[model samples]
Target: MKFFSRLSIQSKLMLMLLAVSIASILVISYVGYTSGKEAILENIYYQITELRNSRARQVQSYFNYVQNHAITLAEDPTVIEATVSFTDSFNQLENEEVSSNMISELWRFYEKEFIPRLQMNVDGNPTVLSYFPKENIARYLQYHYLVKNPYDVDNKSRLDMAQDGSKYSEIHQNFHKFFRSITTRFDYRNLFLVDSETGNIVYSVHKDTGFATSFKDGPYAYSGAANLFETLQNNRERGAFEVIDFTSFRPSYGQPVAFIGSPIFQQSNLVGILLLQLPVNEINRIMTGNFQWKKDGLGKTGETILVGSDYLMRSQSRFLVENPDTYFKELKKQNISDRIIQRIKENNSPILLQEVKTNSIEKALKGEEGLGILDDYRGVSSLVAYAPLKLSDNLDWVILSKIYVSEAFEPIQIFGKRVLVTSAILVPIVTILSLFLSRRLVMPIYRLISGTKKITSGQSNVVVTVPSDDEFCQLAGAFNKMARTIDEEKEALEEQIRKNDALLLKTLPAPIVKRLKQGEEKIADKFPHVTVLSANIVGFDEQCDLMSAEEAVGLLNDIISAFDDAAQRHDVEKISTVGTSYLAASGLFVPRLDRDKAVIELGLEMLRIVRAFSQEKHLKFEIRIGIYSGEVIGGLLGKQKFIYNLIGNTAKVARFLMIVNSVEGKPNSILISQNLYEPLQEFYQFFKMGEIDIPSQGKMAVWLLSDGSHKK
Candidate 1:
């Protein structure tokens, strides 16, 4: 107390101000630090998640494009025509250009359509099976069920010798040669055939060149042919995977390469296995390129890598080595201990840690995606993203991407440090000015209090007069103005809400209406509904049954247009059409106003349209519709995909009723569920029919609309 008394009043004020300034700076710094840390972490996590999603989409896109191209190649009338012609004239060998043209066409398909879009390097464009009708591999598998046991060694040897020697045999060498051409045309080095029934290794691409060695004496070879069968059985039961060791030869390095094994399935039944071998280096290169990282300053800081479900390093783009031994040692030197190694092995995806590897990789292996970042774990800092690989049979291994903290978050840290330094220099000057103009601050504070009082009284247009060069005074004036503007805008916003409510009521049902108003959730809920209607042309089937296929399709399309018009007029929603059956429904998101009435009205309108259609187009049978109503559920089921549907008991009943009601009643008839009939008894005309049996449903009472004769 005595020490304080010795100081002058001005000195005391300065000391107090200095103390307050220091405390303010500390508080600001702490808050800024915490906020920056959280922001940086969130940014890293968001980026990793985005990258994983992008890669998944890219993979799916590639697959879809490949499949579409395959379908196009299969369906080209030219290919089909060429194949048919070749099959018919094959025994006679009448046209060489026809076969040459077919090959040329396939070559074009490969160069123009497939190679540009996908990573697949085909040996050649796929060949049409029609060109080799007797040796049609797809069809052969289609017809034959795999026999668990096919043959003994003696029988297999005799079959192999016969197959190797015969030229015009169903398993023709020329066909194999042509297939090899197809694979090579696509730049694929490997092409092989699997005996669909027996799982035996048939002719490979190398065998097509007439350079072959029998799998007889090598350690990789089966002890006897019996052992080969056993291996096939094991493969069939366990599913396909990369074979680490197999019977095959390679260049100078005898080290085993990766072999992708694919099980052949015909009509949903496993037939055999096809094995394609590529050097492990090849797969590593492709995988690396697919998930390659990009960094602003450093070359892709987060290394794109892969680990097998077994937790072994499968491939790494940034960390490459011919052998695992040296790399394992290197990891340990970086403080990744044996325990860390074991933990990493446990995870299949990218992981981060200072003490231990996280389970993000394990989740990915188990078919769930996960990502995270950790510091000082195992004494190393890292940020990681992990995703499961797309595998056919086994749990897909996890792909892990990681970058050291100093590398991954370097930019953010640098920026944050700059902000802190700038703030440290600027805040003290601002604080000193604030202390000197205490009197000026009092004037604005009083004016602000007055403005706030007006604002509270709902006079939002009130403005405060502030006179000062200080930024705080300017900020108070701006805030006062902003408040006034905000109050005026609120009125306009309320009006907009009223209009939106009206629109929503018009577009959605009662439940959706209430939920959306409360802002509970935006996605539509799935609910069960009970009716489905499918309409089709009645006599057009018979009329076009004998007509040319193209002409028949044209005639059927004309009839379906009339059905669409009727559906539109009656406010029914069309789901899809199969052949002549036009499927639709009346009650989906919008429940039926009068379920029975809606069904009857739709049936009558369809009859009217089909009658008009017959008069205009000279069609015989008009239209037959199938309507059944039963309990089924429908809603948007995915985050990224949206579909609105009708489902329930009523929907099923509507479908079943279409056939039964139409068959026994008139040219067009509406069928109603028993529940629907009970409600509309007083308003609609109907004739009660006893219980009837449906295909899937046991029995239910049905009614026929009386065509407005016996109302109620």
Candidate 2:
């Protein structure tokens, strides 16, 4: 402590400044770093969540279009009539001879060619359908429907039975051509019609082994179409649409497929089901950007994945589609379980094969929408935003948009490093500057100290000199001037003190002014019983109109000044004067036993003062005085332009009696309410003035004081 005390002021200031500057730098750095990082994270999360919502809406809109298309196709009159006729005819068939034997040929073809190939591909086990190649299944199904020779003979035979050019052959041809054109134009995997009553596949654009089989009892009954059939049967509305999630579609050689079906109703009875197989590529295009992720702002590890209620991926993974090597490497780095990796390797696709059970996905499937950081399907920590895709009641899929957490926060990390480096370089520079500033600041102060010491030792003429025009030099000049005028300053200070005291006396009561000068924050007091008096100069406004503005103001000022002097003589507090009305109170600042008598005396004195002024000026003016005695509350009113004011029923009734209900012709009369008259009746003589109504206080008894009458 002694060492610090002995140090020069400049050295101490330099050390203190350096310490404070370093501390401030550290605090600012920490706050800036944390706040900047939080802002970046918040902004990024907002952008990612917004993007996720946009993509989800787009996917929803696409599906809505597909659903409406299916419903429109189902409600077509031609399609509905043909489906109903075919369904009825097939259901009633029992040993009917067909013209071309095309049905028999289709059954034969399914039994011999399509069934053997499917069984062989599945190693003679129906449960091994997942092993079959989708290409082979598509080829078999295509041949049965596209081969024209078998159906050409049937067409010729049916044309011979035409009545008005609307033969069965023409209707069937038109329907086949329409289905082919639709399937090609819309990029549908397959278009099929199912018998609503029997749950059988009545017709399909791509016929396969499942074509001639009942959907409920066929080898491919477990396909998504079976579920679609059941849903359509339950809902017989023509526009009713249902979606079946991706599954091992047996008609497509156990390839992953989804179905959207709308019920075909004819005259309120369900005739058939119109079903469209949704291509996975179409979904992948909508979700993963058609393999152009970079253009879509999904960087290397950013992708949008669709997950179903079963926890399976509904859309193809971007990494798997565009960069399989990178995807595989990440899978290993994330330490995903080998069982799942092996399944991915075997299936050669993650769509409908990979299971994603992250917290975001689970919450989304439960119908909650949110964004957070969680490990995704590949076991990589990522920032994921998820929302449920509410296409219909049957489709329970959640869309997830994600990016790796490390990548998302990379900019923040870079910014922190830069701030740290900048701070490292700035500390020494700040320390050096602080030392220089301390010297500049303390040198002038040292001179001022020397001058002050000299002056303290009776060298009153000593002056400090600093060579710059800054505050230090100004301060030195002020010190010098202060030394030269020390005695005069004392006299001026005394004068200022006297003026301040006078001003304070005018603003507050004597005791309140004393307490306030002693540093009291508030000044207020309640006088349980005090007398309030109000005197108004009658005909003052008319007199002012007849006189010049300045003359009128001067006369009113003189009249008020006279009243103020009279109030002082009676020891009454003048609250304020509002043009032509003078307000004063007694027993407020200092309690008195004879407050009512004091107030009446003050009012009589004011009336006398006004009369003297009127006679001296040769002006006809009268003063009406009203006095009331009751409890009153007094306090300072404002912070600036403050005044000591009194308020209560006593003050209110005094104003009402003096101004509101004063006798117009007898302006020199003093009006006293019953409350005041009863108290001072013996000291002064009064005449009964009858009753006058006062607002808010009801009727009040009034008395007019007789001229110069005293009973004392």
Candidate 3:
């Protein structure tokens, strides 16, 4: 310590400079690198939130449209009449006999076509006993629709009629075209009509196994469509709508599906339930962009997933959809059981089977929305944005948008590496700078001192020169600019004072400005006999919405300028204009003996000016005027922005009268208070209007301007 203190003054200064420069570089470099990383993270989070919110909105809008359309379809006359016809025909088929050939043929079709696809996806053995309908009606329809049908499953709805030789086939052929169009147009998986009285699915657009099956005790007794019908069955009210969330529907070979329905009422009697199968593809399309994840800016490892309240996936998983082998491999590493992964492969979908127990999804299910980093379903560290969806009361689902941590922060890692390299190079350069800076520092000090002395002598446009292009030269250049600025600012200040006085006179009255200049803090005056005419351009605001900014402002300037000119001729003073209303007064700014007559004439002239403007512009504009004569108080308000505004019962009453009960309750009409009407009744045409109980000011009589020739 003693050896360091004994160093020379120049050695101490060099040491101090070298230490500060190196330390500053390290601190600045580290701070900038950290700030850039945070900015990137914030940007990714913002993008995730925006995409997540937009997807949620689209899902909500689709469900809302479906819910409303379900109600409309339930009330349609065609659906109502068809529901009754099919239900009756289906009942009549109960007495008919199903021959052995028809039963064998239908069972053979199931074994040949349906069993192969159903066995591949389901867990247990396929049952032919329980599926064979005990009632001959369902067996008969299934034989023709399922056995004799030539169309594939995708085009089964197009099979308008089958040669079943039954009453139900005739009815099915009559209404099949209309119901099939609904499914195709709205992208619904299937459309159904369930008999409310019998709890039977009387009709189906796709002619699936659920057609003619009873939701009460059929093969699909507890399916999505059945649950929805039971919900409305319990309610039993008009306009009753219900929905069932995604579940393993047996009718679709145990695939995930949802249903929306409304009750069908005919003459106040519950007839049937109108149900539509909600397609899983539409929900997946909205969240995953129809599997075009990279095109939607989700990048390589970014995608959105939907989670139900049970923590099961409601939409397809991006990993499982893209590469099942990789997804199952990661799941095994997370200790997921082999049996569940096998089941996922068989179903070809993770929906309703992939469980999400991560904190990000748990917090979202509880309605806590935000961003976080946590282990996703694949057991990988991920950046996740989560929010609860508001699509329906029956659906308590939440949406999550996520990306892998490594992929999202790759740029941040590169940024830190570059910063470290740049920082290492700067330290040695700072050390070399200290050696040269200490030797030349004394030479620039003497020149700066000479320039400072000249500036203190009150010299304008002073210049300082340093020969080298170093820090000292930059200091000299700044000194020259500062001296010149001081000279220019002095002249600018003198001229600004004169222009301010003139601008103040244009906004406020001259007398108000004079009092403010004379140091009056608060200026107010009350006059006994004043007249105020307040008017509104009736269609001005509506017209502005249809016109552009330039056109609207031009129209307003032309109209207000004409009103100002009319006020000058009538010995009235313009008070203020707000939006669509213009106010003018007489006997307040400068008193006149004809204050009541002059202000009324100003209102009458404004009406004429608006009519002319309407004809010229082909616009629908008219002026409604209210003239009142009474006492008023005018004052100067605001310190920074002085305004000459009037306040009293007279101005308030005049403003309200113009809008409420104008003459004939129409446009281009004028109303005057009794105080002004009493003096001008003999000179102009006036008609009595019954008194109205004005707010804050009791009942006051008013008169409307009549169109008859005046006694002027």
Candidate 4:
């Protein structure tokens, strides 16, 4: 007590300042830490939610594509006519003597060969024939035998006869070709045409155990195939499609399978069903991005899973794909059913085929979309973003994008630790400095405070000059040095930013580049009435082969650069250049009513530019230009090596026009589709070249741009 009473005024002031400084630092640190943590967590949650929604949209688009394809197939004239003809023929033969003999032979084979195989494989289940009456089975067998044998005199081997032009053989061959093409083009597991009236499987691309079988009352009547036919019968809408969940498809040897079926109608009358075996690989690619988690911005512990309303996964699992052994161990640890585990072990099928019950799945199935921290199916703590996906009336699937909570919040945890350590170290240093400064800091403190105020007010050149030979002067000098260094670094950073902006401008349009620099994550736009021009230098490939690598590259660059100058002159946006092909468009980022005119002018200028360059280099160069006017969607693709690209039927048709109409000798041939000609017919002179047949688009009128100088 006596020592405290004898303390000097300076000592008391130092203690007070030290205490106040430490208290302020603690309060500010606590507030900053809490606010920063909350903000980071909120950002992460939003990012995951957006990712989940994006994936859901992609899945929906895939399903829409499948539905549209199925509808188109069902509406095909050949499919409708063939189904009706086949049904009529089968009905007419029902009362024939030959049909009776074929039925008797089939019944004998069924008893001796089919039932034994069915019993051996399906555990002697009586349900195989429970719904099938003997008469119905006999009728179905008769139809199968006739179609398969075609011209068998004696009901012996059902091998195809060498009758090249038999009606039966022609019908069989046409149906086989149609089914094979569909299967190959779409990469489907199988394609089936089921008779609507008889419920018999008429044709299949890959005929397995279920081939030539009746779905109505046959051995496989209780499967998804039967259910799909029933659903189509109940729904008579033209474009309606029915989806079946993944199950052990008997035809594919117990491999997990799903189906999509659309009704085939002939003149508004139900004829048959066009069924496509849904390819799981396509869905997996959409869900997990081909198992490329890192490319998808999902780091080590992140994955996206799809769950159907039945609690089964609709897509493959990352854990299973990356580490099957670890997945098996985890499944066993989670106490999955022995039956499912055994199936997985024996067949090496996806774990998604097994039921998965988790909090996220339960919520999503109940039409809930949210983000939360919960235990996933593997009983691991995870941060999950989940949404309900209503692909169609029959498909009630859910998408879950999840990552380990530890990984999701790892950055926050690290930052919090760093802040805590910094505060702990800084608080003591600040207190010690406060005490020391309070002892001799009067003059230097005033000088530093004045100079710091000026610096904070945007005066980077402020210098604190403390002439005293003490620590205060040294501290002032250090402050001035830091200010100068910060000024230099600021200038350097601005220069780097300028360079980045210029580089970005070269890759993307100016407006899009500005938006991206302002932190726009995604850039995409849909232009309803845009004109796309695709120009390719004819014989460029041959020319490259003849010239040296450097010469070829230099020549290509010069040609593309000339085209770029023409595009800029006409206000047309250059989309991209690949090899010798230059793709440009009008009304893409910026909308203009005269987009077609702009594109035409650009195409003509490009022809002139190429001709001049060819004359200058003494090289024989010819250019073909194709322009099509329609809707298009453009966007930036890929995170690394990103490119701004365009897609749609318009882009495809334009490129096709260029390739199909281009000739080697023609120096400047500009082919325009009917769509483009319709709008510009009055403004430009185009010589009609008659109708040209285009795949998918059918026959269309085409014209050659003759005189671009004439304008209406």
Best by lDDT: 3
lDDT of 3 by residue, 1-712 (tens): 7977997555666788878886787787778768877887899899888998988888888888999999999999999999999889889888878899988988876777666666665668887765667667788888888777898865677789888677888999899988888888889999889999778888999877777889988877877777788889889888778888998776677788899999999979889999989988899889899899998778889998889988899988898888878989887887866767777888777888878989998888888999988888888898899999866777899898999988888887787777678767876776678767775674566677777787678665667778899987888778777767866774575467557777675566667778888999899999888898889998788888888999999999899989988988987878777877888889997778899888877887887899889898888878898888789999988878778888999999888788664445556778888888888888898777778777787998888873332675
The segments of candidate 2 whose C-alpha lies over 4 angstroms from its true place after superposition are 1-15, 81-173, 207-209, 266-269, 289-300, 333-348, 435-712
Model 1: lowest-lDDT 10 consecutive positions:
140-149
lDDT of each: 0.50, 0.74, 0.83, 0.75
- Per-residue CA lDDT of model 2 for 1-712, tens digit only, reads 9999999988889889888988887898789878877886787678768778877887889888888899899998877987876565444432333333544454455455445444432223553233222232222222334333344421321221222222333444557667766877887877778888777766666544455456676665666789788878887765788988788775565567888999888888888888898888788887877777777766777888889888988888877877788888877786766766655666566776677888998899889998888898888888888888877777889998888888777777787788788878877887789888997889899899998888777665677889899999899888988987974665677699889888777656677778777987677778887889888888788777788999999999888888778888888888877789888888887889887787788787777788888898778888888888888888777787767777777778887778743554266778888887887788888888788887777888888874585786
Native-referenced Cα lDDT, model 4: 0.75
Task: List, residue by residue over 528-581, the lDDT tens digit for candidate 4.
Answer: 988999989887777677789999999888888788877888999988888888
Q: Lowest-lDDT window of 10 residues in candidate 2? A: 153-162
TM-scores for all candidates? 0.36, 0.52, 0.58, 0.50
User: Distance (Å) between predicted and true CA of 506, model 1?
Assistant: 99
* Model 2 lDDT, residue 527, Cα: 86
Candidates arranged by lDDT, highest first: 3, 4, 2, 1
Model 1 lDDT per residue over 571-671, tens place: 76655566766667667557766544565567667777667766776757656655555455644233343233444555555656666665765565555
Best by TM-score: 3
* Per-prediction backbone clash count: 53, 0, 0, 0
Task: Provide the RMSD of all predictions against the true structure, rounded to 1 decimal.
Answer: 55.7, 32.2, 47.4, 56.2
Q: Find the number of clashing residue pairs for candidate 1.
A: 53
Give Cα distance to truth, residue 578, candidate 3, Å. Answer: 99
Ranking by TM-score: 3, 2, 4, 1
**Residue 536 deviation, candidate 2, in Å?**
99
